[model samples]
Target: MRMSELSRRSGVSVPTIKYYLREGLLPAGRQLSATQAEYDENHLRRLRLIRALIGVRGLSVSTTREVLGALAEDTADTHRLLGLTLGAIQVAGETEPDSPEPAEVDALIEKLGWNVHGSAPARATLAETLASLRTLGSPLDWRVLLPYARLAEQTAVLDLDQLEGIEDPLEVAERALLLTVLLEPALMALRRMAQENESARRHADGTAD
Candidate 1:
């Protein structure tokens, strides 16, 4: 496909596509002539991923470039690839943010026997959230979250199962990002429905799990 076709199919403007090409976010198309080039399926897939990274995730060009670098790496470590992509979504850096709940959060993760990185942004966010809950007069600690953590373990298994058997890193990363971020709203609604159902069941039986 031509760049114009890529632009049309991707809903990205031609100038923006060219800009991505120049910024290394999008790879160059095959040189057909002095002023013409042809793109293919890989390019189209990457274009969509770039759009998602910028439009949905709001990553800056440089950050998107870094993620694309991870995708293009020669290693077969899908774990590391997914980590970088998901970590970007969490706005993580090399270190956790300074907060009062750091130790508590670390202990909680250790108790759960999860292998999450120390610098994961979710860790810091959990710490900050605990403090906020205390300020709001509803202090819930990690012990209270233990059961929910077990549920989360199952949910994580289900989530990763969707990506099983994929070989294309670009496609895998794109699917992971879209599914994780885009499904959150629906996932929350499903949770609400389940909560209501469970409440009714417990009340009707006069017993709880």
Candidate 2:
């Protein structure tokens, strides 16, 4: 197919496809003539993957490049690459210029007395996320995030339970990719539903008062 067909099929514009080709994110097509290039199925698949990584997962171009490179490697390396990508997206607690360390996060975990393993990525993710939230001026302290963290943990467990039954490696990878892409919207809708329910309850309680 020509660039136009590739663009139409992949839902990426011609200029953006050209830009990706220039950046070496997508491989250059075969030069069919002086001014035309022919693309193939590989290009179409790659363009879709790139769109998911950038548009859905919110990964930066550099990160997406690294991820695509990893995916292109031998199958043995793909799992490790996925782990690295997940770690990159995990939030660590906030840090400010000369800001004090998040002793509160540690304290909260300790108070909860949960047996968190040393060097657990979840801890680091929570710390980073809290840090980022603080940077964004979240007034509620670390305690406020505990419920959300518990909900996240439950959701992760459910997701793993569902994934455990899948047999095909490629299917597993595709499912993971799709889930990572779509989870944000799913979570947002759940939160919005909860908010509406809470508002209804509050209004009913006020009437009783």
Model 2, span 85-197: residue lDDT tens: 45455445435555433455676677666665555576665656666666688745767767866776788777666667765443454456667657768889989978877
Q: Per-candidate RMSD vs. true structure?
A: 4.0, 5.4
Q: Report how far off residue 115 is in candidate 1 (Å).
A: 0.8
Looking at model 1, residue 1 earns an lDDT score of 97
- For 55-91, candidate 1 gives per-residue lDDT tens digits of 8888899989988887688337889888878886785
In model 2, the worst 10-residue window by lDDT is 93-102
For each candidate, what TM-score against the reference? 0.86, 0.62
